[model samples]
Target: MASKQAQRLAARQQLQQRMAVKAEEERRKRTVLWSIGGVAALVALVLVAWGAVTVFGADDDEAGASDPDVAELVDEAEAASDRCADVEPSGEGALGTPTEGLTDGRPAQDVYLECLQMSTPDASATESCMYTSVDGTSPTPLSVQPAAGTQKMTIVTNLGTITAEIDTAGAPCTAGSFTYLAKEGYFDGQQCHRLTTESIWVLQCGDPDARGAIEAGTPEMAGAGSPGYQYEEENLPVEAEANYPAGTIAMANAGAGTTGSQFFIVYEDTSLPADYTVLGQVTSGLDIVEQVAAAGVM
Candidate 1:
């Protein structure tokens, strides 16, 4: 009887902690968003935003892509799971998919909102973060704070080497993951696979499996790749009209908390729903991405 009582008490406490985090996220959403839409184009790039299919959201039936990863994470009281299942959407979500009902695959838009809901600070973590292990191959990130308030990420391409200034202040966990992945030589020879020429101008890269299929002249056969572990989003620009501006680099995921190695570099000022996590600014090598964008997608 005493053990059961203790278990109940513990469950109640966990629920309260989760609710507190969700409430703060709601408050942040209510605030912080303003108009940065008319910021003017730094370059004559594209318009519109990345839709569900092509960008971060995915539809997979593999065991690794099951619902347990999201719903059960919170139910099991995992430290990293902020319990986004309980979050109520502020508006009619991007996909209008029901967060409550599901038969097989989850709606991409719903996954996106879940990402937004849990994209806040833990306030209870040590330096090391327990990124959800997916394939047991992801490298653990170093500290989010490197040096000079920002860390430098150099991307050497066939065209030219592009350098970025990772904003650790904004997305510390993401920064750490990037650092670890880079050290492990994860991005060694991976091709920058997806490039959008229409309204959204970006060079999407980092997918390990995006090569052969795309090169075989069948782009549709390409699959989404991950870093083997997963982590929730952080440093969301939920308030900006042009949330992703020119020279911005951000993560690409299949849904909320499904962030993988894939990322997009914005060569234009774009406004998508504030679902993706902003990594930092592409301080250099914007020209390289721009040149590729100008040439258009193959």
Candidate 2:
């Protein structure tokens, strides 16, 4: 009876040892699976973070590419002659000297004889007109007035070339300003910053301090650059329905007599109150503007 009892005890001890080994093996297997899952999750998060950085980095690069440096344009401006220094008006109806209170919005007498009359066959029948400024300051004084006739200018751009005709008959002052600025290479290396497709179908350009070129969150300083002077409006439409037709090139201004270097090209018949100076008409390259407009703003 003692031998049988001892044999039973040995059998029970062997069974318990086997069960302890099996439990340890199962615990190790579960630990290996948990470690693999953790590693895989970390790899997935890394991939997602890399993808986000790549996508956002690409977008920032594209924006930088589109916005050209304003410093380049400023360098061009500095190379030109300082036409505003010691300036004096020239031509038949030029001001004898610079005067104050000219750009005061309200109608004032032509103090400096800056007002001119268009010469006609009957010289006595010429109507008097004034060249007003925005801040009561003249732009680099045009030493000479533009000759009377349809002056032609070729606007070369990266996209295309635009040919325009400055109508000296209708807008002599505005034409003269453009002629002077073009000669000084002011418009070179400049891009059209603003494009409005709806309500106003036009492409505005000629801001030396192109605010668009600056990165986002930077203060904008566009549409504020000038040739150190301003001019009055000319050739405003008489009839309300006399809209600026497609291909019409006109000046952009802050208000009355505030014409600056910025100008807009009408891609479609746009109805705007005749507040802006009618600079000229685009003879060619209207299609280029239309194509740009079709692509829409990026």
Candidate 3:
């Protein structure tokens, strides 16, 4: 009986020893798992930081390679988006086609407006801007001469007399604003600020200082800046399928509803979405555009 009891006690002691060894092994395993998890977390954080640095780092070479004319267009687009950043888009679309006199496409002007409405800072939105039911037979006129009932003004330069007709029917506010500025002689004596030879574009005579001057954090000269105002998109007409042709006088938008004193004359007929207000056609002098281009002010 004593030997049997001794064997049983020995077996019980061996069992306890095995349980302790297993517990120690489990503890080691738990520690290793936690250590591995911590290392993985550190590695993930390092990768994220490295990715951020790579994505946003400055690329001077890439910027230098970009065409200046294209850059200017991009800048204008950014400015336009920034100007309209605050305005929310309404679902209602504009009244005319995507290209009024030119070709046609999908997505109406309201969709473009929506894009400008939703665009973020440092981004741009685009659409096919058109004015149709217009006479496609004649290439658009170089100088505008308004009909008798329309609002018109003539600016005489070395090239000859250039007539500008305000489109009251399509863009009343823009037309009115332009007429007001012209009557005040806002464009007179101001040199065509930027003349791009390669693009054949002329941005002329609106800056109070004819000399090139840029405002800090702004594109225009100090005096040329529109003093805090924008007009509603209600007056403008738009079409979904067509785009506005060259020689169409349109209001350059800063963004949604942010039309201003600055305007653009399309030197070459290219397709632009109905983003700008087409005020009128140039009835006569295009040589003046060439003359303005020859005189560099930018």
Over 4 Å off, model 3 = 1-149, 196-205, 209-224, 234-242, 294-298
Look at candidate 2 and tell me the lDDT of residue 160.
49
Tell me the spans in candidate 2 whose CA falls farther than 4 Å from its real position.
1-139, 211-220
Q: TM-score of every model?
A: 0.54, 0.53, 0.41
lDDT by residue (tens digit), candidate 3, 43-140: 99999988775674323222322335324533443343333233342434232333333221211221111211111111121111222212345221
Model 2, C-alpha of 267: deviation from truth (Å): 0.5
Off by over 4 Å in 1: 1-128, 135-148
Q: Which 10-residue window of candidate 1 scores lowest in summed lDDT?
A: 110-119
* Candidate 3 lDDT score at position 194: 39
Residues 94-114, candidate 2, lDDT per residue (tens digit)?
112322422211111111111
Encode model 1's per-residue lDDT on 92-172: one tens digit a residue: 322333323322221122111111111122222123344877856644443222222555666655555566777755676
| lDDT of each candidate versus the true structure | 0.58, 0.58, 0.44
